[model samples]
Target chain A: MSVFITAFRAFGSQVNIWLDTATPAADGAPVLRQVPGWLADIEAALSRFRPDSELSRLNRRPREWADASETMLSSLDAALRAARITGGRVTPLVLRALVAAGYDRSFEEVARAGEAGDHATPVPASRWEAIQLDRAAGRVWLPDAIDLGGTAKGWAAQQIAQRLAAHGPALVDLGGDIVAQGKPWTVHVFDPFQPETPFAVVALHDRAIATSGTDYRRWGADRHHIIDPHTGAPARTDVVSATVIHPDAVLAEALAKAVVLQGSIAGLDWLAQHERAAGLVFDRIGRVLATENFQAYLTQTQTHTQKGA
Target chain B: MKMTSTKRFAVRTALVTSTTLATVIGAQALASIDEAARAQPIPAPTIAPADPVLQPTTATGQPVSAAVPNVVILRHAGEVSAPAINVEPQAPARPSASVVSGSAAPILPPNPVQIAPPAPVVQQVAAQPAPVTRSSR
Candidate 1:
């Protein structure tokens, strides 16, 4: 197994990179650099931290049509499509809620800010649908400032995996959002109370898995970083964690948020009926739950699995 | 005395036929599944929803979902059979209630007390598999 792990902080969160392949490369420095460059683009397109970034700029110039890159436009397009698919289950309004809840900075910064974190409060769930994108013209027009946090980082990791397609079998994990070109890779789902305890171990054979958990990203015990569009606050659910797996990283990433929003009981049932994505949900009781397909996917011998159309 | 002879003959004939059929089917279809389950095999990480087009699955009555073990769900066929897995199709569904340990409150529309499916959680094995040592010729 050719394995590599790299770490850095981008998208305002510490990132861990792991890759596995059929043949090991002599050195992996060049392979690793691609990740940072990828992060930089995602930040430019999605980061709310930089006032000049796409999201920030859109928040400020909510009316003007700004020229957008194909990536930015496409990402926004996908998010809209996902929103439609999930029935407004997830919305970009979460960005406003995140900032208002003292998450103006990266997660690490929020964790460090303590009481001072509550300084610059804003309105909740700033409604992402109001912020529209023009795919044909590669431009974006916003009606108000909304947080794209619900989808951006996870989407970025997926985009990176797509660009790095030439690198053979690899796995890129942006925080908990992951996309693997292949497996021999072991990913442990974190335990909220004692994160040291891994709730599950996934063996991926060229697939993507993204997890959304309030564990490390919590404000208090009840408050988490994952905002629910419905309530415009952190998602409140019985699910300790939800991990989504599919060949499409974007789909897996988006579904992770939906699962988290749905909570364990409802989310688990939802997964049971919806087989397009394989899922795992952990309850506070420390029980494991997965959809039928997700269970079956785990049974196939490692190496290859078919996904999407 | 007449009843005793008939009972004896019936028992002998039934045993011979059932054993012959048992050998022909080799433990009986679907029988080994429950038997192999005694050890509680390591739970699979991903779950597949019942796809009418791709996998064969029984109608799932529950709203929230959990992964079912090894039972292949075929959507189009509306049938489930043993298969290698990975290549199978899945029905898209939502996660369960109260999944994580010390997690946020339940997110379901109605906080119902229901059993979450098993495919999501990866359980520890009761016994570890044996190691293989290589031999050089």
Candidate 2:
């Protein structure tokens, strides 16, 4: 089947939508056109970088129930689930920590500035249970500020893919968080160090995949976006990157970051506990490790090539 | 006041007979009262059905068929439905067996070649770009 692909920018990353159909004009064009608007709506509600965003307004007032939009409520709900599934390893209440680590502005600004300004001491994330959500009332109460970060992106990807799937088979990629539905799509797992070489290529069908790493978005030594909740600082670990595949994009994103924080050995062990979830971790020494079932998703040609090489 | 033994025995028997008769009559009266109470219908609370009160009607005055309150709509696997009121939002369904289970046969591509940077180099027939970690660049 011919694929109709569209690319745009949102959530501070390039967004790509792929529909498996030959007739773009008849089948996929209209749906593709709506993606940017949908993503913009989500970003307006969830982006922490925007001072006028709903998230910023909620963050300004803590310890009280504030009115929220459906986007805000649903995204926060998804974030809380991610925290629960990861045992608080992945949390939305890391805004203070992120700000302290000099990520107060957008990554573009931080990158262009070349140095993070002096900031306050990092405050450790509060318990995820402390944030209260009343979906029926369309309200949320935060114990402290939160940065949805990759969680929101993953959620947006999943939402878009679900919408597009009604027209045809679809794949939505918000940066690295991806969701594929309706058919098997081959996805490559790239080497964090090399970036150009793919260590493995696997087929994903009706599933989602995400990669989390410290190799990018660094402004200073030991400064990265993936914060360790325990230390309230950038994660100090031997694993440079981790990629996880699961049925849900939100969970995949959370699990990928959790793997990076826990490091390779313990992370792989943790990933095994989750049924039908597989992961690959690349350590600082260039060693590659994958969960036992990860190989099952590998394309046969890639498997053979690996064996021959 | 000494009496003959036969006289005393007759008096005692008479007293015992009266007392037995009175006890039997009292128990029978109590049983009848209890049966009467059981025969009465219990009064139920006077609550009216909520549909007529809360449900809105169409322009034609026909009552709209609203979703039954407290009734959850169950959907088939992978089917998306409107969120039911009062139901906790559930995580997306687990992937189907075709996704999680190992592929039975290898899907061989026609030929593979390297693309360029930003996108993964390897291209197999119709394969899409592999998602990389998010970077500012």
Candidate 3:
């Protein structure tokens, strides 16, 4: 099998697409090149910071039925499902809250700004039920400013992997929100600060693993992305970072966010109830706490290393 | 009483033969059981010889004794001519459901009642960005 790997910038992060194809490299080059355009299209449809993006346009018009693209509709659907599943812990209507938290610009710009104090009040997000989607008409009515930022990356990863499945087996890793199809892929999860040493490595067999952390995209010293919809403030839970392995990347992303937002104990309990999902939570002190059956995903090499250690 | 003396004697002989055969069969069965028991390695059981009365099962339906020593073996007729000893069918063993000690099934703790969080207090206000003036995309 030949491996065609491509990496570029999109979604304000490094996007990597690895295609294991039977076709020759010459033949596979064109097929591999098409993914960047596809990712760009998805980004245009879903990005919250882009003023001309479809999501931004929809956010501008409240209480009006606006025609949405197929991509936007699907992303909206995934975001709504995420909100419902997390019981409002994760929601689509968190854009205003996110902006109020000093995340009004791209994460790069936010990080560069490094402003310490919160300029806006921390108000709770609008309930997810306020946003309505007319699937048959391909129109969405947003009564509130709904942001697809949380589920957008994982949903895009899922969509990209699905699109590439026909050509060959693919692994789409969008800023650690991954989707693997056709065969199992070994994913090593590392800290955002320490990207060199992986704390946990899991093998994905037609599965996905998403990591949500408070270590990245910070404006203030303590503040980071992944805001809690409940209080509209940065999650003050014990979990510093959480990685969830699930069948669907979108759900995995949601699960990861929920894990960090709810804290380690409640998060582990919640993950335990989901038979298909397993999680690893890093505490503020850098201790690792994993859910049941999470050890099953540890690579044999890592297992041997732990034994020797 | 109505038949001849010959008939009566035949009936007595038949009764004696049946009794003798049943006794022989019972002896053979007991011998076989003893031989089988000797062939197996048996653990020495500590018997404290309680009241010679049988105790009923507990409220939770657990057996008190590990071994049943007073088993009544019933012999069936019509097998007198057969050389092999007839063994009676034993009752199926009942699984114990012990509440006091080691129970087969695990005991789960009572589920805690979940109290839902208070509803979010939504602040009603006019649109902040003041609806973008341009037409919808």
Candidate 4:
């Protein structure tokens, strides 16, 4: 298979783009080159760590009408929708809570500093209804501090995949928040602790898959980025990692984060109840449990060799 | 299973209240409002709750359904056909992979890491497109 693969760092993680086509890499270079710009725009608009970012400006502003770009508006719309769908389990109004949890800076700086968290009590997220958007006016009224975090990343990936799909089959992976368009793409899920070893592999046909866990960026030994909106503390989930597959990348990412925070029982139940999505949840003890419908996407399940086989 | 509109609103309101308290207190010494709400036995619902005994616990030592009740009573859309993606493995290849074509046979490179006893194998299976039976609204 002739494919054009490109990788770059963006949004605090590696962004991998794969275009499956018989054409030369140059044929797809123009379309591929445009992806980074899209991601950079999203980062500048939604990143909480950037004091000059649109999200930061909104967070600092009074509860008055503020001007917003198309990117910020759409991202906020998706974030609020996710908050509603998850019953506020995944919220955009967690910026203060996130900073209170010691994630005030970029994840890179946090990891490099290795500073022990001050163990601040978590403030529950603000109400989703607090955000008012006027699309026609290109303005928004944010009644509380908000953070778009992974929602923007997933939305950006979806946009890139949709755009590139017009040219050819494309896969946009923004740090494991993925969208596969135009063709089926096989992806592997590994143990979060052992990222190199594969636990299961699934094929996505015009679908999206997102994995959220405490493995990626950690400040103190136990302090990771996935914060519970209810507790304001880092989520204490039995499942070390939760990967959700859905037709929408934005929805998949939101559900993945909600699943990790919900733990395995509610997580799996939520997935099972959601007819359009499936998921795999890995617990802290190496036990793997998947939703009933999740097997449909499992083209292969890589397992440790049987003893003496 | 579906929850009564009244019950759903109550749970959502409780959650919103808990959240408001957290934000108001600046996340410093915020009280456990969910715990307080859960401590008082909630009213009996028209529908039987999913057996709590069967629920799993988190590392925090709380039941998965802790505090919030009627979590299983979600609003689902009508059944949708699952996407026709082939999940069956076709090529013998290394486990550590980034991307593979859906239609073409993947080229297998040399397997580098070899452990004792049984080799780590990619167990293949036949593809099955199951209709999705549930969804979150």
lDDT of each: 0.56, 0.70, 0.65, 0.66
Per-residue CA lDDT of model 3 for B1-137, tens digit only, reads 59899999999999999999999999999999999999998689876543223322222333233222321101111111111112211221122212111111221111221223232222222221110000000
DockQ of all candidate complexes: 0.03, 0.04, 0.01, 0.02
Tens digit of per-residue lDDT, candidate 1, span B100-125: 22223433211111232222111122
Q: Name the best candidate (by DockQ).
A: 2
**Residue by residue across A1-309, what tens digits does model 2's lDDT show?**
557677766776667677877453455666677788888888888999899999999999999999999989889999999999999999998989998999988776665566775667777789889999999999999999999995887898988887887788888888878898999887666544434345456688999999888766666667888999987998888766788899999999999999988987788788888997888776665455666566567563221111112
- At residue B68, what lDDT does model 3 achieve? 21
In model 3, which regions exceed 4 Å deviation? A116-118, A192-194, A301-309, B1-137
Better of 1 and 3 by TM-score: 3
TM, every model: 0.63, 0.69, 0.67, 0.68
TM-score of B-chain for each predicted structure, in order: 0.19, 0.32, 0.31, 0.19
Tell me the tens digit of each residue's lDDT in model 4 across B1-137: 58999999999999999999878786543456756777898787665443432333233334223222213211111111112233332233235422222222222222232222231122111332211111110
lDDT of 3 by residue, A12-113 (tens): 765667777774543445776787788889888888878999988998998999999999888889988988888878898787788788778776554445
Ranking by TM-score: 2, 4, 3, 1
| TM-score, prediction 3 | 0.67
Give the winner by TM-score. Answer: 2
Off by over 4 Å in 2: A22-25, A300-309, B1-137
Alpha-carbon lDDT of model 3: 0.65
Better of 3 and 4 by TM-score: 4
